[model samples]
Target: MSRLRIHRFAFLGDARPFGDREVIAEPREALEPRVRLGERPTDGLQAERHFAADEIGDGHGQAGIERRRGGRVHGGASISAHARARPGRAQKSAIPDNPRRKRGGIVEVPFRLRFAFAMNLSLYVVTVLIWGTTWIAIKWQLGSVPPPVSIAWRFWLAAAAMFVLLRAMRRPILPPRDAWRFLVAQGFALFCLNFLCFYYSEQVVPSGLVAVVFSTAPLLNSINGRLFMGRPLRQSAIAGALLGLAGIGCLFWQQMAGHVDDRATWIGLAIALAGTMCFSAGNLLSSRMQAMGLHPLATNGWAMLIGATILTAGSIAAGLPLAPDTSPRYLAALVYLAVPGSVIGFTAYLTLVGRIGPERAAYCTVLFPIVALAVSTVFEGYRWSPVAVAGLMLVVAGNLVAFDLTRRFFVRTA
Candidate 1:
């Protein structure tokens, strides 16, 4: 490095040393030193001299460059002086070191994080299987039991189990004051009313049929969202929705043509439709509750408790059948319904809502019917007619269309 000695020059007037013996002009008169350096060139001359001598620049020089002219270098001195240093051409730091950088720009998580996500995802799969299988189990259980009795028993048992589990974990069963109303409403919709209609429908209609009816919930939500919440449907959403409805219409037509004379079956189908509407409405309710800062599990627990109480009271008041010769098989089914179906399923589903959002997670409804059909075939000897098979294919196609999966397939083909 070539070293340069700079002399005090009043004519140069508060200039910075550039190359050997050259003083760069002070940015402007605004940057003129308060004290005239001509009278006492040697006064602050020490600072300038030291700065000129030092390869590592001094504070004033740095300050002169930074503040007055965009300084590019600074010496290790006082902070104020360091602050004045030339704003060094910022070295491109490591991504983690960058302050203004965005996340989601990189795959930052390690394999360990990916493995953890996979485990959580596996738990979700277990939840789905449990939920799907229980639909058939629920149908079987409802065969002999009154709908309210069965619903009440399932929830009471679940609440008991949850209470025990919570006690073990030292978690509180009682919620805070503000949450009671939401919990009650949630309970009514999710537990009492939803299950009441579903179980009653399943008693008359096939479980697989109930599953198909429930699959239309997203389509219902689309309408509900548009009407109540003023969410405008995109053209793609509209087109997909129409296609899905057309598919459902094909299935409905097959069912009606095959079994049009069964009034009881039609009643059951009507009840199932009502139950599904309630279920879809609950989605919006749950979303609202979440926005109000309630945890889904806590809301569900409270709601289940309220639902159980209401159903029990309603059963007694209506002089409905209470006991159903509860066998071990029935009891085991109830346990499964309460724990895995009600608790684990809701927990996993709500978590999924938080992760991927409500709309995307609801795609589970499409898959759920397929699961129900498969389970029914195995357990209940549900033989699919040729028409039924065609209906099933339509349902699958509808779901693909609704979810834009078929759109991608077509794009790829094209």
Candidate 2:
């Protein structure tokens, strides 16, 4: 081996000369010249790798290339002296290391990090299950209560519960003035008009079908974001939108085809479509609010209150009685919708948005339709035809494509 000098800071020994291919593997305490080392030099300290002059280089044996480029090589490896060097108060030295863990040592996976993954997974499950089942709960409220009045009760209870939760968590309940206007828009679109459309639509169609329709919100958001916010539309999003639209068409083929079935089927589809548009609009407003430094939870609480107020006022003006249904099932459904559906589900999903990312958290939209449809078969006595099954497949496939999950999985794994 060609002679080469490897410089290591003060380890457990004096300045040592590295022989050809000699590896001085040991616990090393690196210190600056004439500067005292810290009390815990071992804190996050990594090992230094020495290499023979012939060990690292291109085919032409340009081992000094790194040195010529103001750095040095290590152990015939890609990691260089300049790459892992940490600057201390007095001295900086090159070391072979991993930012996530120490090199050639214990892989320090933190206990909290493992739990963090579990917690996020739990949040995703709860959000999907609760939102999906709430379709049946919405259907339950339809028998006795007027749709507007029922929604008012749900949001009033939900708003109160959400405010209490925010207080317990010590988050500020009132949003900034800038966020209030957007909150109003979000409330109308998300809480009031969105639910009103769905509630009315469900009165005519199966609740599970409404969920399949609502699953198109992501596509709607993509389209509206492009139209209103000037975001570039992706080709995949367009393809997904076309597939989802075709699926909706198939789901209502007989009804829209003007056969002998209920005429309200087509009307229900239109209403659900309008509601999805409102939902997509609300999502954009929420994005704007988030950009203004508002937490979605805070805006959601305020929006629920505003939406409840609007629904109550609208109900009174329309001469609908404000009293809630006295039946046990109705009351139970109301509480479930208020607490778990709106408050808990929203909290979990938004938490996931913050933790995993809005992109991944929104995948919950893809899973909940299956849960809703499954619940529908048992409770609503909804029979799935071959066409309906095909529609469901298309919708799910479109969501997967729209989300670019294939690309994402490959990117992460790669």
lDDT values for all models: 0.55, 0.61
Query: Could you tell me the lDDT of residue 50 within candidate 1?
Result: 17
Maximum-TM-score candidate: 2
What's the lDDT for candidate 1? 0.55
Instruction: Give the per-residue lDDT digits (tens) of candidate 1, residues 1-414.
Output: 111112221111123342222233221212233232113233332111212101110011111222212432222111233333233333221113333432332212233234534543554466558776776557568567777888898888776766666677665567678767767776888777888898778778865466567767767766775676544454444454455444544444544455557888789989999998877667756655554434556666777778899999999999988886468888888888888887788767654443322344454665565566677688779677766567667656755554455655787631
How many steric clashes does model 1 contain? Answer: 7
TM-score of each: 0.63, 0.65
Q: What is the Cα-based TM-score of model 1?
A: 0.63
**Model number with the top lDDT:** 2
Off by over 4 Å in 2: 1-123, 205-212, 237-265, 350-366, 378-396, 408-414
